[model samples]
Target: MNAPAIDARKWMPYPSAGGAPTTLYCLPHAGAGASTYLPWRKELQPDVDVVPLQPPGREMRMRDEPFENLTPLLNDLLAAMDGVWQEPFALFGHSLGALVAFELARRLSAGEGPRPAHLIVSGRRAPQHPSRLPWIRMADDPMLLEIVRRLGGTPDEILDDEQMRQTVLTLMRADLGVDQTYRYRPDPPLDVPITVLSGSTDSHVTMAELEPWAECGSAGVDIRLVPGGHFFVVTQRETVLRRVRHCLVGSP
Candidate 1:
């Protein structure tokens, strides 16, 4: 018999509030999971419902294998998030998530799905720029741990346990692999507005690297420099949410 089909609904475990005017689909950074955006619900609710996309191999989907390439992951997400395209929605992603959001927006613009109202990307260089970080799978375990340490959003429990540490490293390798191997294909400019959020002190992504987002969006790109390093999506949460709210709901 054929194996049971994977239920994509599990990718969006959080139920919508029903009162929101629009939905914001948030994707997480490397080594992180959907739960990273869970707190955003309280702040964006009643106007913008926050939907966190949980990729395989982390949190609730821990037993499933993560994608080691961007193509397959994007293909899976396009299929998994089919319902989201039918509504008024926007996309937000940080670091590895940024590439995912950008590609998804591109696919939607190509008529694979309905276009998102806006695309907000954080903590990553524009796709045309070469990645600054080395491929994690090629690095030794200690080096991988050091790289994760410098990025700084990982929880201590996973880092402390030997087995858990190895598991997380595998996940991170798969996540970074998606980033390190991505190739940007030139496409017609997207009609959607793009918002690029950069950390002022983020060594990983320079302002120069963030500026090219303007070329991708025909509607225009808004670049905001927030205070923090790499993980500003977490370090400066309120500021990011305020801007996101302003974009989607006309709120402060």
Candidate 2:
């Protein structure tokens, strides 16, 4: 069966020349679009094809409602990725995207399909570990604003505007619901190697919280520390890109 076509607006493709053995499929954090990785494509070597996966309900798919659960989201993504599983591919996801990548990898490995060569998870704790904070099920307007403030990813201009805030808040609530409802089911470590990235000052996730990612994979796991808070990728782009490139092409 042919794979379903992904919403073009959601996914940003970075094609590469031949002889590049690996393709890196990047998944964005909640409330973000594929453009988040636009800079990485230019910074990385020519051989790696950096294809950023854009989830629905954002950017060009702004008209579509955001997903509120993991199962449906992963199922749709797996379908979209159907025909493009030929080469050695790796999965990279940040925060919420990290959880999706790990779960998707599990689904792919269980099915009669090729698995990603590596899983690069950033800014998220391991699945087996429960979140440190209690779930925020229903946030009032003020609370929502505070949550967004603490996260520090949403733009202040958008959050301040009534119309923009409404649109973003709708998506944010749905994304948070998905995150809150998520219950990690433990399983044996994967054969693929996993790399975890964490920020030294990220209050949401700590070095200890990120270390358990080593148990998620059998081959081995490596952790890299960047110098910033939760949104380290934005502040330390060069350092993050350097680490990613090294992992993708450096001596094994």
On TM-score, the leading prediction is 1
| lDDT value for model 1 | 0.86
Number of the top lDDT candidate = 1
TM-score of each candidate structure, all chains considered together: 0.94, 0.90
Count the clashes in each prediction. Answer: 0, 0
Q: Which pairs clash (backbone N, Cα, C closer than 3 Å) in model 1?
A: none
User: What is the overall TM-score of model 1 with all chains considered together?
Assistant: 0.94
The digit string of per-residue lDDT tens for model 2 on 8-56 reads 4344444333456678888888788788887777666475677788788
lDDT of each: 0.86, 0.79
Worst 10 residues of 1 by lDDT: 78-87
How do the residues 111-230 of candidate 1 rate in per-residue lDDT, one tens digit apiece? 888879999999989899977777776899999888887778888787989998899889988898888888898898889989999999998888788888888888988889999998
